[model samples]
Target: MGGAVSAVAISSILIANRGEIACRIIRTARGLGLRTIAVYSEADRGAPHAVMADEAVMIGPAPVGESYLRSDRIIEAAQATRADAIHPGYGFLSENEAFAEAVDNAGLVFIGPPAKAIYLMGNKAEAKRRMLAAGVPCVPGYEGDDQDDLAFAEAAQDIGYPVMVKAAAGGGGRGMRLVDEAGELADALGLARSEAASAFGSDELILEKAVLRPRHVEIQVFADKHGNFIHLGERDCSVQRRHQKVIEEAPCPVMTEDLRAAMGSAAVDAAKAVDYRGAGTVEFLLDAAGDFYFLEMNTRLQVEHPVTEMITGLDLVAMQIAVAQGEELPLRQDDLKLNGHAIEARLYAEDPSRDYLPATGRIDLWRPAAGEGVRVDAGVATGMEVSPYYDPMLAKVIAWGETRDVARTRLVRALKESALLGPTTNSSFLVDILQRDAFIHGEATTAFLDEFYTGGFVADEPGGADVALAAALLLDDDRDAAFAAAGYVSATQLGWSSAPLSPIPLHLTTDRGVFDIGAECLGAVWSVTVGDDLFAVALGQRTDHAVRARINGRTIDAVAAISGSDIGLSVSGKCFRFHRARPGMEDDAAGSSGRVVAPMPGLVVDILVKKGQKVARGDALAVLEAMKMQHQIAAPIDGVVTGIDASKGDQLASGDLMIDIGDAAE
Candidate 1:
């Protein structure tokens, strides 16, 4: 470890990020009686982070570049608030060396590793060099600072047929490409370089050997200025989509005591090489033969830290603060004990099967499960709008139990009890991941999603007739045309009316199929009959932001959410997310925006065209990335790029811009 600092604690702490992570840190700081301040963009004026902090400061507009990325404003806010420490939550300026340096020069505690450590690890190539020097196993490839595509591709070919071209400036699967052959090397390297250039403002790249069907395993390491450091075991983050980790669990199923000891010692050595401090993670790709290679080290708390906390019964955030306050590590390497198993599932505001497109809308029902061994770290609430200006991650649902199976069961049960009503989400898909035979058998890998997910997504997807029955029963209100004791039809309007009664039409949409049917409600129970099928449902108490409805005679569980004029129901083994019928027929399937649509709420980072510009398919037309990640919106086909919309920085929503096309054949 590095030399000890004089002291680390300060009077107050300024959180340098927003959303659920901000809220999560606030809770920890408040529990420790440490004053906390929150910073937000315009779109997050009423966001969860602002409401949870002791002090809230308005930064800039919704665009991250204008708000979160502006390190000058953040430092100003910290000084203005008299905050002596700055806690950069994961994302934004967390790994930014310059930001850390500015904070240190301002005579404030950075509450993380030293600026030099951040600088060294902030660059992938340099970190790999440090790791190799520390005798930590690294991928058998090149980490030299090389920007030449041909040179890097040649090196990649030397590493063998399958290799990964990655951004040397950052990690999280961004700026990463998997090349299978020499012919595919150029395109992969170029794309990786461009994405890296846009996201991290650095096009520098490194080449590495791709572990065939490797499992992503990372070790949680912590160090203090007192020259004490230890490892908190490992987490398996193998389940991923588009290179983004989705499901993470502690005490990997394939983990062995010998392997853990070997990797743990190596991780400790790596941290020591950087003289690291505070909470950080050393990630690795573990192959089938028990061999592992250093992937990258996250110099900040990971999104899956709660899983580590659950298994160890340790408040990692509190520990981080204590260490930053100059406290020495209390436990030795041998004293660190691993107990139960824990798992975390990321709840995102997106449609999983619809290319995992980010979504935006008002959260009508925000229900998260809270029980023993189940914890929810969430940012938004009921009535909150999921803005396009931020990450689609709404919350993280973590569960703990004595055994892995128990933990998985608890997580699935907790998720089933949650009801988040907004735009289409990935709740059902998360459940599917948990219940998959391979996932259950501990056979998960980075390509697990690629093997499972097919295409497209429908909201409230209840795929079978059983789901339809459950939905119908939940909405039943016992309607009849015959006269009742009040001398009028029971299904008629509340006020006296002489007009002839007509059948009431109700629509139900889910991931399964859309249903246009009739319904009736009777006290706590509802009955609905579609065609020859009769259904009955008993409503349960409101749990979270959803209404649990039990279908009579069906063992399948169901949930229904009422948002505005729309009702989304998940029943049987399927789901249906649909809107209330309007004047025109609905298109169940829409085009994939072959031209270009804003993937998330973001600003046009750059515009590279004007009207009548000829462009081919896959050409970089415009760039629109939200939540700090850069997305290159490319052209879909050969056509004239007609009608340029905005300038360098214009905020946009999905489908907000349309590039006109005359030749449909193109």
Candidate 2:
């Protein structure tokens, strides 16, 4: 039970984060009758969170290292805005002990776990030691001070192969690797260390036996100064990509009542281990034998906290704020209970088929799903630019239902009905997972995505006629009165022109590959054909980036937005980007275009080749860092480098020429 302890009065709170999480915290703070202050960089001047807050302050540039991660700037913003408390809404400095201390020293309440708790639990190795002492099961591995490469390799051999090399100081999926063989240990170690040092300012690593097909289940724990602690059930975040969770559901389907109680008790002990206050999470790897090992403790709110809230009918943020004010948790362990099933799908601006590389562009259309049991939390709006400076997650689509099946179905429907254009997303991939039998049967594990769907998730391509129709609508004068008028004409009478018009030939490239479409407009009707398929379309009035049309006697609703030289089309929540390729401009299979271009906006972190250097196909030519991840831009073919246009630290836009690689001599 919590006790009445000294508490600081708070009226206004400053959120030291951006995007959806900032908007989430502000909503809760407003509900609690508190003014919310938001901080943003130049890139987020018009972001939803900044505009939604009671007041906003510009901190620094777009780069997070110079902006959101700058604790001093965040504190200054809070003080200048006359805020009483600061909520570091996950990521950035949310789990940084120094940031917590800074907030406390600035005479403001840190709406999270205490600074000492964060410090003690932040280091994965030390936290494992603490968990072991507290009788919490830990994965078999080494967390010793001797992090010598040789010693680590030996420890991996001792713990056995397929051990996970992880940065002790970092969260998310960063600074982590799974070494399946002895041969892979060295590379995994070096890369993990480098990523750790870069991300968390510490290269210290810990190795653990990679639990095969384990379930990633975390308990939401809340504590108060009065010494009260409670676990709000468990969330199975087993569906992941690149070590980051993509889907999370509360009241894990596989969890029995006894298992839930056992895990909940362990989580409570974990919170008590650090004397944690406010909200935190105790993550564990649940094995097939029903045994669970402590993975790590997140000393802040989690990105998937909404699912927990949906199932428990609790506002975790509000509870966090109250606990920060020294108020005891209203519910005890016995009083807390789970209700309806809840699931959350994280929509990210990344291509699932391309190793999850991030995408950046303006959101031409953003219409979240709407209906009962559906809740969409997003910080983006139509025309908002999705930059390379932050996480690629655009929003969280959460659904709740009376049963797990009901919830799963609702979530799948919501994902299919939600619309986003411009940047590619994993919406379709999420729907695929929800529909998979492995997931529906509640049998998915940490290896579910890789093991079951090895080919990667791909959305179904629209019909050839549909594709041709979309292209024709985009190229046609959408505002033409004749087009709107023809939409109302009888289908039988449509396309009956006394004088036939010349067919408009268009070259198009889409996710489904390239096609040559021909269109002949007859008043409001258009004859669209792609290859052998022909489609008669009645074009309706256009609205902003969307259009209403009837194709082959069937009405179709779609969004058509112009993005650069490409056209983006969205129908039934699936989006496709098509480049209008000129007939003579298409590159041959040999990539004779003779140019190596940046695939997306990013910072050139490394130039692997110099001018005049010879390279082969698939050779790493350079490394570009974007969305806090590194991507290798490889050579398209065997060629000799003729020019280098970018250097380390150079910011590049999508299509910016990186280097010129002329064809190699025979």
Candidate 3:
């Protein structure tokens, strides 16, 4: 670590990152009476960071390669703004040793560890070797420097099946695959290596034994230039999807006082070996036997640091600033105490049922849940696009309670009330995983994602009720209501409506069906029946295109919008009605024909077909760029394109029809 003598007074600190991290750092800096400078790429000019900081600098164009990753431009921004220090708030150039050195050479304090410490722990293979030498327990697998496929496969087999093939430079869960069988190892290796190479610019990987039934528990480590270090307890990150963590909680479900001390000591040892300073995370894999193994150290602050803060009641960013100012860590291991448990769920613009593909769109209606144990750390607000230039994560929703179960349940409740409309999100997926029996019973593991979630839906999910309700009632409440009026004993209004009408036949919603059991207007109150169920109903004032009804013994708010003679209930939340209609209720719009809809809001990457080309159902039609990734838009069914409304390089938002696939075969 740097041995520079410094004082706490700093005019302003420049954040070298963008999005949520930039906003987060600025908020903390403001809290401590420090002025903040935010640098932005063209893509993030309208982002939260642009407004959060006291001063903003336009670094470069949209691509991170030209802006955020360009360390010289960042340092120059700091110099221009008279920023006394720079905080690399994780990702991008956060862990770049040369960036830190450049900041120091330019006479500005770098709010992280020394460049030498970063270099020492930045390499995965080298980090493991150093940890092993420092008496830290590591997974029993080959950490050899071999790139040959045959040699790597042999090492993987030696480690046995169920080993993990990891890219040495991989983070954020990309370029990593789990191999449960020997026959699958070769394919996994090739894919993992290719992805890793593409992502991190280094395909060189190191094989490691995948600890069976292990929980991901990482310790928050902090150090100062004076050799003072302490662990801020552990965070459980076992709730994951495709090896990417979705939910993380503090004071792990299985962590005990004895185990915490041991793991904390090991993390401290790992940091001391490299003279690590500032905020860093020492990750570990805790097996069912209660033993822990060193699982790489993140040289920068982590995404789930909020959960640790909830338990420890410490501002980690503030601590990083103080440490950067040559101040020793204010607390020792004895002073640390973790109270109330906290849990954090990552809100991504991704569809859960679909391979967790990230989504992009304008957050038309964005409202974060408030009150009672809830905290939202978000980057984008309404109208912000989840662009393809950066991470797909929208926010980190955290809930703190007296117990872990309370936190889990509270988060679930918050998610239930939270409404998001414009774009598809993973909110419903979090609800599904949290409501599962396995999660409630504390059966979390790295394999939990694939185990409970099959490629299909469960026989009876609560989401079905909403979909069914959308199908049965919200679709055609008027004509059907006149028919199904209960206790009528007459066909006065039900006999006809403008034209001679027959009683609408009953159709099932889920297993529940609607029937034309007649209707009677008793004074102001009306009665209707669905099967043998009788309900007293009343009509509220109708808005244009929607009818509201009060039904049964409970008040049911249904938006019945008539699409021709049928109905289209705009059921809000993640469940926007089923992809297919229930049997006979199939309408024209329900069928995927003649329209190429915008999947989400994003920039158009490529448009593959001409206006009159023939296409298949799965043909790559257009590429939509969102949330830092490109998603291919495929044709719905075999058809000729009637219209091409969009072209490559066009800026688009959700629901804008770009292509039309229509009229080939009915």
Q: Which has the greatest lDDT?
A: 2
Point to the candidate with the largest TM-score. 2
Query: What lDDT is reached at residue 379 by model 3?
Result: 80
**TM-score of each predicted structure versus truth:** 0.86, 0.93, 0.77
Query: Over the stretch 164-219, how does candidate 1's per-residue lDDT look in tens digits?
Result: 88888887777898888999888787677777876777888888888889999999
Position 251, candidate 2: lDDT? 82
Higher-ranked by lDDT: 1 or 2: 2
lDDT of residue 580 for candidate 1 = 55
Per-residue lDDT for 171 in model 1?
A: 79
Alpha-carbon RMSD of each model: 4.7, 3.2, 8.0
Where does candidate 3 stray beyond 4 Å? Answer: 1-4, 456-553, 556-666
The stretch of ten residues in a row with the least summed lDDT in candidate 3 is 508-517
- Candidate 3 per-residue lDDT, tens place, 205-239, comes to 88888888789999999998777889999999998
Q: Tell me the tens digit of each residue's lDDT in model 2 across 1-666.
A: 444588667899999999999999999899889999999999999999999999999999999988999999999999999999999999899989999999999999999988899988999988999999898888888999998999998998899988999999978998899999999889788778866776788999999999999999999999888878889999999999879999999989899999999998999898898888989999999999899999999999999999999989999999999888877898998898789899999999998877787988888888888999999999999989999999899999999999999999999889987888888998888988898999999998999999977887655676775586677665564323344586654322343444445778878887546778888877667788888888888877677766778888888888787765677787776778888888745534324466888888998978989988999888988988888777888888788999999999899999899989887773
> What is the Å distance of residue 109 in model 2 from its true position?
0.6
